[model samples]
Target: MKYIIGLAGIVLVFLLAFVASSDRKRIRYRPLIVMIVLQAILAFVLLNTGVGSFLIGGFASTFEHLLSYAAEGVNFVFGGLANVNEAPFFLNVLLPIVFISALIGILQYIKVLPFIIKYIGLVLSKVNGMGKLESFNAVASAILGQSEVFISVKKQLGAMPRHRLYTLCASAMSTVSMSIVGAYMELIKPEYVVTALVLNLFGGFIIASIINPYEVDPKEDILEIQEEEKQSFFEMLGEYIMDGFKVATTVAAMLIGFVALIAMINGIFSGIFGISFQDLLGYIFAPFAFLMGIPWGDAVQAGSIMATKMVSNEFVAMTTLTNATGLSARAIGIVSVFLVSFANFSSIGIIAGAVKGLHSKQGNEVARFGLKLLYGATLVSVLSATIAGLFM
Candidate 1:
């Protein structure tokens, strides 16, 4: 029965995209069907089978080890402040991103990450029936982040058409950066994060191909990275360390502000309406949650988390999920997968600003289509969660 609902959710998602499609007639059903079928299969393999159990166990343990290693840096700086007795989420969970970012930088400096993203992206492009750049952005965005991936393709930003540009930005918005994957693992099951990452990679393309259909000229489907002047090995490491710290501080600041503000807003709404703002939103989003295979009884609570992810960010939503009670395992699984993307309201500014910093006119165009990007990316998240729901 849950699988049936999940299947219906998938169809509804594509129909929603198709109805709002910029060029409905040009929507490629072949790639869309292939991607959805692939997502379903991948979700099953990752969640229900023995191979998935072994893979997820290794992934969780590996991330756990990395989190332990990251704790070393946290211990060195704050010492007893981050001691296990009373370590806060910011210090223990979020700050580890600094270490992860440093590791990513090391991987990038050695050219290991770029080579992998390029070729993996090349293969994905062939399967997804999109341009090489669009496919590369999806994988790169998963690793490098939404904003930073643009720098990797900065050379081509100016020349790419609007439709292709939308595809790139959509992929970025739909996927989460690896820097925070540990933090997510701390809050939710690692399998959901891992599965969501893979599903959203394809889900982003499926929705984008429908909503923003266009043909990439084979002659212009470039996969070249923009080269930068070489810095000494130590210089690069130091730079990455600083960059990691910046990312950590940025997330910490956002969490403090957003979480506190949400608390205050919920207070006001509760005072006046006899219900919290999130509860009201939950009621509003409950139907969508139900369609995603959440039991009707749990739909309101699940929808609240979903709405929270869109309004604030996934971190805040995941925090809520971690502390939540009365939800079934299936509801938790679907909600956890849903909160894995960077598809919130604030990302509009972040993505557009990132592009604007590189190219002004194109950034303005992205800004104009900002809401559409959010709509499409949010659908990508829903699609992934729905598919994961079937197997869970």
Candidate 2:
């Protein structure tokens, strides 16, 4: 019965995703839509059913090749640093983020992402019915992060209509940068880098479209096809090193701030309530953990990690997962990756203000849609977790 309900929900979300169309301030999304239903079923099957166990095993088995690939990277860079059987945390976590960021950056130079943007933007153009510039920003922001991805379409940003600008800004705030993709893999599971990347791509596409879906009319002639020189392999490699520096620093900073904030919050809770803040958060998100297929015995302990992700960044959530001493294996995999995001409550203002930049005159609309985008992004990640839980 749980499986039945869960599977049914996935179907529902897919339906809603299709109907999530817009035209001039009127969202035509059919309630109980496909995307929402798909997400719901995914949560059920992954979290509530025994299916998660099987999926977890499958995820390992299927991604076995990744272990080999990862090993190759370790051997090339830091031989003896990685055990073939046990992927060392540093190699698995840090290197992937750095390498992938560079790889994506080089791809950006070659215009691969732009090509993808144009293709996706064309489809989104129909759903959003917005200017090419706005649609382009949406596609670019999803694959890349806020400031970096905007470089790809910087010209569009300055000239885009206010409503379209808001959409693009909302999308940037709603997603993570490519720079941190590898670290998430290291934290969740060495193999999940690919999965998280794919999921991030999907999450961005979905949320951007949802934000102010009916705000604009289409304009293609205004959109241009910009071209650029491909970087030589050495040049691209150099670019990665530069990008790696920036990403690593940003990640380090986030880790420091969030880690400190968690410590501060924990101190307060312990001082005032005479209980651990983690324990409180655990209970707060326990039902959600249960929904993600964690065994009832360890759900709240796991849910606290989810709470941390919602309040902080996914890195902090993964850090908590790694540091957590008594959690069951059942709680480990599903919760780690599922809780990964820039989905914290603090993101509400960050994303809104970012998008508000696009709308010089419509900061109010940007503010309203920013909240919706954050919720949508969080919901989609929950959907990611619930679905991934089944596979766990």
Candidate 3:
């Protein structure tokens, strides 16, 4: 029964993408079919197999050690604020991003990341039937982040067409940055985070192919990465450390503001309508949750978290998911996978601004299709969660 519903959910996602497709005739079914099969196989391997357990365990253990090392820095700077037993969110969960970000910088500095990103992207381009630049952006976006990823391809930004630009932004919004993956592991099970990361990579392409289909002209398929200005090792390390701190502080501010605002709105709604705002959103999103194979009884709560992610951000939604009660393990796993992407209203502006900073005209093009980009990316998340449901 669950398998039937999961299959139906995939069909529903394709139908939604079809409705929004700019050129319905250009939608490629072959790659979409192949990718969907791959998603199922990967999800099964990652969620149900011994090998998957070993890999996820190893990945989780590595992050656990990294977070502990990061805690050493945090304790040195802000040692006495909290009690010994209590773990503060900002210190324990968010600040570790700084350490992870610096590690990413070291990898980038030594060119290890670029080498892996380029060759992996080349392999992906062959499978996805997209241009090398598009495949590279998707992989780079996962590692470097949405805004920073554009800097790597700044040379191609100005020359990119609307169709290609849409694909680029869609990939950025569908995957989370590697720098924050540790932060995410702190909030949810590591296996779900790892599964979502891999599934969303393929899911982004699947939805983009359907909604923004275009054949890359072989002659125009050039990929020129923008090289960063050379800096001494220490100089580069300091910059990434600062960048990581900024991201941590920025996320802290967003949580402070968004969590309070949502509380206020929930209070107002409860006062007037005898129900909370998120509960109302849950009611609206419940059907989609149901489609993802969450039990009908728990779908409303799961849907609310899914809607929270779309409206606010993944961090807020993950926090909510952690606090939520009465949800079955299956529903929790499905929603955890669903909340792993940057498919929120705010990301449209973030991606647009990132591009606009590089190429004004191209950034404007991104803003024009901002909502469509979010739509496709959200579908990508839904598709990933749905495929994951088949195995769970």
Report the C-alpha lDDT of model 2 over 180-235, residue by residue, as the tens digit: 64456555664343444345444544544553454443343367644444668878
Candidate 3: list runs displaced more than 4 Å. Answer: none
Which structure among the candidates has the greatest TM-score?
3
Ranking by TM-score: 3, 1, 2
Cα error of candidate 3 at position 385, Å: 0.4
CA lDDT of 132 in candidate 2?
58
Give the lowest summed-lDDT range of ten residues in model 2. 31-40
TM-score, each model? 0.98, 0.69, 0.99
Top candidate on lDDT is 3
lDDT of 1 by residue, 145-250 (tens): 9999999899999988889899999999999998889989988999999999989999999999999998788998878798656888888888877887888888
Residue 207 C-alpha lDDT in model 1: 94
lDDT values for all models: 0.91, 0.60, 0.95
Q: What's model 2's TM-score?
A: 0.69
Winner by lDDT between candidate 3 and candidate 1: 3
lDDT assessment of candidate 1: 0.91
* Model 3 weakest lDDT span, ten residues long: 28-37
